[model samples]
Target: MKILGKITILLCGSLLLFFTSDFPDFGDANSPASLHLSPYFIEHTLEDTAVPNVVTSVLADYRGYDTMFETTVILTAGLACFLLLRIPKRAVKNRYYLHEPTGVTLRFEGDKYPQESDVFKRIDSSWVPYDIIINFTCRLLIHFIQIFALYVVAHGHHSPGGGFQGGVVLGASVILFAISGNLRAAIKRFGEKTAALFSATGVFIYAGTAALCMVLGENFIDYAALAPILGSDRIMARSHGIFIVEIGVAVAVMAVMIWIYYNLSSAGKQDEGL
Candidate 1:
């Protein structure tokens, strides 16, 4: 089966590469893609959407339904992993601790005693000696990573990045925490319930925004109709609406990535994980 899968992938990639030979040269002005809609999108994006970033305007406004469905696919994958693998009940055996003073390890049966003093630090079942460099460096970098991710999302209208890209970066920061520190710390910071809620809320914000336009007497996902609510002109309303939906996409994608990571890493046991 694995060999067959590899052959299939190779065949598909070969076919795609062969087809690419017939495609127009890069930046060819006479190409069909360049002639048909690309020109119009490039010329009118600023006027129509009031967003300088043509890619963002197209993805968040013109092609929003597709992006929504893509986000749904991500959410679905997370849910499927959770449903299939999440273990509600599991027996934990050994509890590991690190003795700070003597640099020795201690293991206790079942759970650790409640009255255990601060001499020992309770560690994950798979815990290693605390690496001062990795832990401290991650602590220092996590904040900057999150802030940069937010910047990418918010400034995508004028820049190259967008919600999907920004969300992936944000998710990577959390995953970095899991890698540099411990999965237990990551789970404690962003629990399963919170991640699920974030994923749902993001999709809701996007779908609800589209529905709102319908309620305002326009077609579904039409941002122009949001003018009244936003106290802006039709073009500006569309711009703001795009930003709003982009935010939703970012939130959903971020949560789904984290959720999938947690499930796959722990095999859904929700205990110590990579």
Candidate 2:
């Protein structure tokens, strides 16, 4: 039975690889991908959507339903991390060395000490307070990162950036803050409760704006109905709507990333533990 199972798995894998050979080559100028749908997006997206970045237009407008699901995937990952690793209210025993000798000449009952160096001295617990430095730096970086993330989200329509790229960057900054500072500090900046709220809020913003078009007797995401409120012509409304949704995506992604990192690193410690 085992032999038969292994053979079946190998055959299936080989068939998958064989079929994949028919897929488009990466970055081939003459490939069907480059010549067909992509060409239309590249040459005409700016004229149609009034967005200079064709990729952004494709993601936010032409193929926005896919983008919505991608954002949901991020949200799912964050929730999974939170559920699997959230800190329990009760405290658990922490297993870390309080004090141990460092030198070349120490071995007793299958224990060994590495050779001492000046570098080790600097990093020694007696000399440095890891918590304090990490907390301070993390606090400072969060503000700067938030501003930069907003800029990336806003400028996406005019340039090579967009919601997904900017959202990931924003998410990473929060993750960095979590790693450098600690779970508690990171949560203080944006708690899991707040993160969940913002995630829903982001989706609402995107869907609500699109729904506005439906209410105005147009297609779901037809931005032409927003021309009056957005202070632009029909063409420009699409760009404006895309920008709004990008902001929503940025908020959702940043919150979810921080939430995930906190749950992972802390390892379910209600109080600080290593």
Candidate 3:
């Protein structure tokens, strides 16, 4: 079986290499994408979408479906992680906690303590207020990170930042909170259920905007149809539509990042982790 597997792998690899051998070299100026697609976007994006950032226009307007489905894909990945990594219950023989005053680690042997009470259930093994300097410093920076993330999302039409980048920044803020404090602290503020819900909500926002355009009697993702509703010209409507969908992307990406981190870092328990 092992020999057969190795042979199959080698055959597949050789076939893939053979198929791609004739493909254009990386960044070939004469390639189809560079000659046609890139030039078309660069020349017409501003006029068509009223978006100064060609990349943003291409992502949110020209190839809107690609991004919508990509958001769906991110949601699917988060759901898959939840299904595969989440463990409903866990057994333990020891418990640990951090003493806030002295920063001493506390350990309790055996498993005779409380289990069901909400307050006592998750009392053991917490890393919160562990360090005064690090905790305070991170707490202060979290607000700025989140603000910058929002700026990135909103300013995407004119600059390099956008939903994906902003969402990553926002998610990193929460992750920092989790690290500065504890997993339970993070969970208390932004639980797994909330993260999953927010993830779905973000995808829904993007898809819903597209559907709204279709229902408004235009082709799907045709933001020009939103001119009347947005009280703007067709081109400006397209730009506004891009902004709306970028918000959706930002929300989805942020929630999914936190959700995946919670599951993977805690080994599916969501009890305690770095």
Candidate 4:
């Protein structure tokens, strides 16, 4: 059976390779896509989608199905990482705490710890969290980065940014928070459950929008069908649909990035990250 499987795989690979040889070469002007598809999109993108950026129109309106699936792929990766790496978090027997008053850190074994003091705070590591520069810098700049990420998601249609880019920035901000302090602090601000929920919600927002178009008696991904709900003409509705989809992509990407980082950093234990 193994030998037969190997032979079948080899035959399939050869057949696929042979077919790929007939595909158009890179930047071939005479290629079918270049000759017909490119011209059509460049000429009609603005009129069709009412988006100034041709690339955004192509992605969010023209190839919305592909973008939706791409978002699904990120969710799948996060789920896969969770399933493969996630382990039940055990009750911590020992912990580290920092005394803010005197710049002191202490480790406690078992459940015994300092009786709730305002000066002492829980820390992921005994060594890293008390840095004067790194912590202050990250805490100060993280808000700006988050705000910029929002701008990217909201203003993607008019410029060189979009959901994917915005989501990456948002996710990176969280990751920077993790790296600046510790995974425990980052997780506290944004919990694991929240990340998972956001990832799923992002996908739902996108798929729901498509399904809505169908429910409204139009083609599955036809944004023009959203005219009634969006309170706009077909072209404007298309623009609105693109913005909605971009938001979904941004949400999913950001959540997935954070989720994967959390798992990998803590080896799925959600303990003190490296």
The TM-scores of all predictions, comma-separated, are 0.84, 0.75, 0.88, 0.88
Off by more than 4 A, model 3: 1-9, 90-93, 97-129
Q: Record all residue pairs in model 1 with backbone atoms less than 3 Å apart, i.e. clashing.
A: none
For each candidate in turn, give its C-alpha RMSD to the true structure in angstroms. Answer: 3.3, 8.3, 3.3, 3.1
Instruction: Looking at model 4, report the run of 10 residues with the lowest lDDT sum.
Output: 122-131
Clashes of each: 0, 0, 1, 0
Tens digits of per-residue lDDT, candidate 3, 1-274, equal 9999999999999999999988999999999999999999999998998999999999999999999999999999999999999986354456665444565555766756444343333444543335889889999999999999999999999999999999999999999998887787898899998999999999999999999999999999999989999999999999999999999999999999999999998888887687
Model 2 stretches with alpha carbons more than 4 Å out: 1-12, 91-128, 131-140
Span of 10 residues, lowest total lDDT, candidate 1: 108-117
Backbone clashes counted, model 4: 0
Give the per-residue lDDT of model 2 (tens digit) for 79-137.
78877877663444322232234432222222333333442221221222467777787
Q: Per-residue lDDT of 16-79 in model 1, one digit per residue for the tens?
A: 9999999999999999988888989999999999999999998989988998888888889889
Question: Cα lDDT of model 3 overall?
Answer: 0.89
lDDT (CA) per prediction: 0.88, 0.71, 0.89, 0.92
Quote the positional error of residue 156 for candidate 4 in Å: 1.4
TM-score of 4: 0.88
lDDT for residue 136 in candidate 4, whole number 0-100? 92
